[model samples]
Target: MIQRSTRFGHLLRSFRDAPSSSSSKIGGYLLASTASSPLKQACVSTNRDDEFANLDWDNLGFGMVPTDYMYIMKCSKGESFEHGQLSNFGNIELSPASGVLNYGQGAYEGTKAYKKEDGRLLLFRPDQNAIRLKNSAERMCMPSPSIDQFVDALKQTVLANKRWVPPPGKGSLYIRPLIMGSGEILGLGAAPEYTFLIYVSPVGNYFKEGLAPLNLYVEEEFDRASRGGTGGVKSITNYAPGLKALTRAKNRGFSDVLYLDSTNKKNLEEVSSCNIFVVKGNAISTPATNGTILAGITRKSIIDIARDHGYQVEEGTITVDELIHADEVFCTGTAVGVAPVGSITYQGTRMEFKTGAQTVSQQLYFTLEAIKKGLIEDKKGWIVEIDQ
Candidate 1:
């Protein structure tokens, strides 16, 4: 095994001499060119391994289980991110006064890799995550890796940690790509240096109930995001504020907290982490991504799938009263795929909705999963199969 310090030094040297060329495209994003460098070989081999990690695949949960390898890259304030390398998955060094630690100048993205029965791994709409990461970086005043760099690093990390990927239908390797201002700064400004890292964790399901409907509590006292803030972006700071509400709701016997818009407080925005949709008759509506709610990739795909199947999908302001009367409600995100809302309690009144296999959530969930796992032909070209 390579010594940790030696591997880190190797990564730094390779990052210094990395190239800026692309050879091909996958899922509408350019893939960085790769030569047979020893560093690259150390990251991933072209052959798949049948031997797997010793873990309870059937009892996996949505928690961190360290994989074998991770991807890391660095950039200065005024420079574009050029290159990165794979290293052992471990804790990273950060300054005591880092900008991310002080001013919260960080953003993150979540995507997943699914293992196929034939030993192939699949990534669904990774280009979308790359684009969203760029948007978040811009919002947080940090330089970001290009889509090519982002997608390539993701592929390298997943390929290097392929053994940790759960078996098909068991779970998936959760890919988390993060961009943070790691440089030290005492004042409230962006840091001088930034870091982009990707790590993977094999996860079973987001909810412990395993696809059972969620009982959400509407948080009227706390506001998740203001109208003109970083609510639309995946900023690290944006999540911390909602945790208080989430914890309080969980304490009150609810699975999660559904927050409303800060401006009116009557308009439904989203849950703490996922985007929500309300279904009535043939019409499906979700809150618009208007600088207050995240533009979730899973939410976007579900809209397309729903529209293609003759459902009228709309993105607009969905009020709290409308949610109470909806026939069905569901949430979507990378973590919570298409989870039906069993009940929503607002201001001491609870409203129930239709759940189970006959609802729209289940139908869309199956369709999305089918396309993601390559069980169906990827006509939309959303699946990016990693090179074995």
Candidate 2:
């Protein structure tokens, strides 16, 4: 069990031990709708039939395919999250003048659930995601669920859509949790209400190259995030602004954009979607999380794993000159997992790195994947098994 702050722990305990009338009402509504809807009927039939027999698990890409159900909860302003329910996966009704639409007052998280060979489902570091979401909600002035509530809701969502989970080695279930200011508000301020939702989709590799090395284009024109910004958090606003640069890079046959610090424009901040790491000789270093980079969970785990494997891991400033001359480079994230960097182009200078067999990235990738798939003992207790 994860520990919570005193005030939040007491509040969550009260909310859970004593159900409010509002929760009862929400639960009743979900039950009635799920029992009567045609979509729900189809979902039940599909769950009863063969699950993976219909899905082409090997060919799944990183795209959203509607699952059976999603978890939802709502809260009023200046209140704790009191209730939640699992409902059919569908479009949500939101006001046109919502804060998320107008002012981008929202945050989201990405994590995955893997199915073990023995028919056990496992989650990787969900508590970390819960903490990150709480911090993000605080930044956006939205009410967030407690750590227990958040993890419980995730387990509920995964269990409700267990049929959609891919096979042991084929793929995994991508879980996306979103929190947004949903109340009707036109002025530039926090909305009067908030919505918390969790949805899952079966997905294979995020990049088309699988574990192959990716070609990165150094982006000097636009910055992904500035100092004292929401770059450290998983805000939805931080993604759309990089599409133009991403499109330009993709057109030039690059896989992603590597951004530099906005102020200096010299040190490497991060990749557009993943955290970067460089290995030179026996030393492995990555950019520090200094309010301008998202502190990735996988990055942290790899750092620890590298240290355990007798590699010196340093978290500090990594210059482009050093990166271009490094022995190996790779990126880590929930979606990307661990992918080697084949080459980087900066100022019309293309630098290549060693990839493929017997590299540090390959070693780390296989170790992490084995631990996730239950092929090795989980000494760090990172895997949380969902009850059947």
Per-candidate clash tally: 1, 0
- Count clashing pairs, candidate 1: 1
Once model 2 is optimally superposed onto the true structure by TM-score, how far is the C-alpha of residue 46 displaced, in angstroms? 11
Cα lDDT of model 1 by residue, 1-388, tens digit: 2223554655566556655432322212223444533223223343435557899998999999988778788889999886676666877777778899889999999999998889998999999999999999999999998776788788888887888989999989999999999899999888999999999999988987789999999999999899779999999999888888999999898999999889788999989999999999999999999998999999999999999889999999988998767999999999988899999999889999999977898999999999998899988989999886
Clashing pairs in 1: 46-388
- Candidate 1 displacement at residue 274 in angstroms: 0.2
Report clash pairs, candidate 2: none
**CA RMSD of all predictions:** 4.8, 7.7
Q: Kindly give the stretch of ten consecutive residues in candidate 1 with the minimal lDDT sum.
A: 22-31
Tens-digit lDDT string for candidate 2 (1-388): 2322354334334434542332322211232123222112111232335545378887999999898778777788888775666666766767788888889999999999998878898999999999999888888888898887888788878877777899999999999999999888997899998989999999999998887799999999999999889999999999999999999999999999999999988999889999999999899999999998999999999998999899999999988888767999999999999999999999999999999999999999999998888889999999999886
Candidate 1: what lDDT? 0.86
Predicted structure with the largest TM-score when compared to the true one: 1
**How many Å off is the CA of 203 in candidate 1?**
0.3
> Against the true structure, what is each candidate's TM-score?
0.91, 0.89
